[model samples]
Target: MTKQQLFDDIEADEDWLTGLSTDIWENPEVALQEHDAAEALGDALREEGFSVEFGVAGIDTAFVARYGDEGPVVGTMGEFDALPGMSQAATAEPEPIEEGGPGHGCGHNLFGVGSLAGAIAVKRAIERGDVEGSVVYLGTPAEEVGAGKVYMIQDGAFDGLDAVVSWHPGWTNAPNKGSCLAVDTFSVRFEGESAHAAAAPEAGRSALDGVQLLGNGIEFMREHVADPVRIHYVVTDGGQAANVVPAEASMEVMVRAPDRAAVEAVSDRVRDAAEGAALMSGTEVDVTKTSGMYGVLPNHTLGDTILANMEAADFPLSEEQEAFAADLKETLGSPSYADVPADRRDEAAEAAMFTEPLDAPDEGTTGSYSTDSGDVSWTVPLGRFRAATWPAGTPAHSWQAVAAGKDLGTAGMLFAGKVVAGSLYDLLTENELLEEATAEFEERKGDREYESPLPADADPYELTDR
Candidate 1:
């Protein structure tokens, strides 16, 4: 079938995909706890005749669904987890459906459904004998907090995949071979003697003092670290009352650097700071590494291929959709992008769906944030693109993002589905594209092998109830 026909297949499944996205957006579950979202996507794939594997990689919310007999296995990724404490109603005004609850602040509600739409369209082509090879849909979870894909890789869930394609929600449709930082998440807890503040303040060792020292050390260490090496932490526990000397306190810290080695170096320094703080406060500190993900190794060949498909399958926003975006833009007021030109701020405020020019691939330029998908890119020659899901200047992990993901985001989501399915069609139909992408992957990866950063006995749901 023609590429347009393949894109049409994705459009054909728009209603079903919309329903899926809406259901996920409304119910929004936090990372690694997306039971309903997982089941919904899995059941839809099963109904489409894909062989389903439930609870893959020992992750209860993770799954793998497949279609077609044999050839090169092309994998498509789907993420369904939401963020914690980001509840917001889908309206122009800023308000939560339920305040302080989970919500799709990152637009992952559309992410999961849109990706499945791509996979389903590809499966249809495979079934019609128009496309050769297999299509596998990977249901990845906990991308916001824990790197679930890292565990899945350790469990050998991605073995035998020829290549993979994925999409993310973004404010613009810029597709390039962009890289992101390597990140590590760890929890630090301190224990000390407790006492009544008024009775005998000197008799008690304060764990809160340890936490304060740790924070101070971390702040000082940040100045010595290289640029773009970010360190963030939150004091999860402290003294319950002013009259009490706390016996226990805990902090969760995340560190990010341009590469894995850099991340390791900075993390080591942070750990030393924690230890020094513990020493000074007369407290014992326990540090546990929760998860870490590698920097993205962008494949130029794969990126170009996806960009071509995106350009070919240009899905413009309808007038009504644009109006929806405009109304949302009114509520958004001033727009903000990390690197937008000052002159473009006003233009970016209006919600619109248009493809940005393909940027020249820069190896040195990496994103400020990190994602679990970075691990998947390291494991395989993976190519990903961002669809314009929110109004211009609307950042991810915000009320605006959650509101946009319902209606305005659906258009971008469908367009993304088409771009993904169209790209898969090209990859499945043309063997040279895969070879080129694989060759690029080899050249880019060099001698670097993917190593999971989780401890040997690490549990996927250690931070949350499974």
Candidate 2:
């Protein structure tokens, strides 16, 4: 009935949560292909009397599970996608469980299971009549490659949600008041005449030339763009034989900025450069928008709530857990994270729990990466946090991250679950929280409407293989 009881409910399901995390971690699947992960978690929720809906947003791996029939609907987002080539055993060494294989480098194996534990705890509370609202478990897939949540929003999957809470694994724990960049991924393909290199070479219009020119144009454009704008590309199709005048070539281009308008502005220029390259090379070029996500609209109201629960929750690490974290810390290295203070780094490596203070969301702050949750945040007032699943200095999408997550991340996952469950309890019981979140959501959204950066007909799932 009380918040402590809600925490108890989460602790009661520790075995189930552990099993879920272990299962998903052992069988790593990359974005949009988390079939086994989705099924295992879905069945677990269904067995607990939650109404489950699969393929809600036309994404085969995406699903929704809900408990309770009335009152405010508090949704928690979960992702199960893993990264490629980050396989590692849960040891201090940089050894892979399967050399050159996929692994939970981003710690989504813990992420998905942690969020599920929170949602299920809320379901238990609802059954006890301690809460008067519904709990939603969003089974989001393909966050690494496919923007699964963005596609879900396009299909109205997030409609009628009161608030959405999220969590991720990181080197430090904090209420995530930080922001992520808005990003758009697209493709450009060039087609032209082909001929023998040695014979009639003058008659061939090289598509490879167009692709090279386009790359050159983008590289030249970097100096003219805003400081925060990031543009990168990869040649997916750069022709076959060197002796032949290549007839076809393609490139995958990605543009990211702090806001939607900036992303749009840079993307338009990239498109223009592609057209110019085609014109100069005497080749035809086709451009396609693949996927995108918006900047996260962090709600201070929801953040304060989650922060309180994060600090209030008991996250004691055992002696063995501390040793495990220390061991993993030895394998971690990050040039980007070089600025972390030496004392903080030394303490965080062995410290059991709690380091960062709960602070107000900083204005104009942005992280270098992008998440589809940013798309979901634009749709609703969202709160996201991080648990110290890995030791200090661990960088995401690496063997070190994948290594610590194998078993050392279990306690952190449970800690996140308790915090989330506790926060959901307050959201259900406190009307002022939702009212404030809604008011802030409207004031911040202003005239800006939610728009998909992808083309109208683009299939989000098609990019899963990448």
Give lDDT tens digits, candidate 2, residues 1-466.
5688877877778887888899899999988779999999999999999998999677788999989878799989889999888887777787787878889999999999999989988898899887799999999998888578888888888988999888998766667776879998887999999999888899999999999999999999999999999999999998899889999999999999998999999999999999999999999999888778898887778888888998788774667877877766655453244323454555554543333633533434788889899989889889888787877667788777787676778888888898889888888899998899889888888989888766656686668523
Q: Which ten residues in a row have the lowest lDDT in candidate 1?
A: 354-363
Candidate 1: lDDT over CA atoms? 0.84
Q: Give the lowest summed-lDDT range of ten residues in model 2.
A: 332-341
For residue 105, what is the lDDT in candidate 1?
Answer: 89
lDDT of 1 by residue, 130-188 (tens): 88899999999988876799988888889999899998997776565779889988889
Cα deviation in Å at residue 172, candidate 2?
A: 1.4
In angstroms, the error of model 1 at 214 is: 1.3
Error of 1 at 183 (Å): 0.9
Q: Once superposed on the true structure, which residue ranges of model 2 sit more than 4 Å away at CA?
A: 334-346, 349-364
Question: What TM-score would each prediction reach against the true structure?
Answer: 0.95, 0.95
How many clashing pairs in candidate 2? 2
Give the Cα error of residue 131 in candidate 1, in Å: 1.9
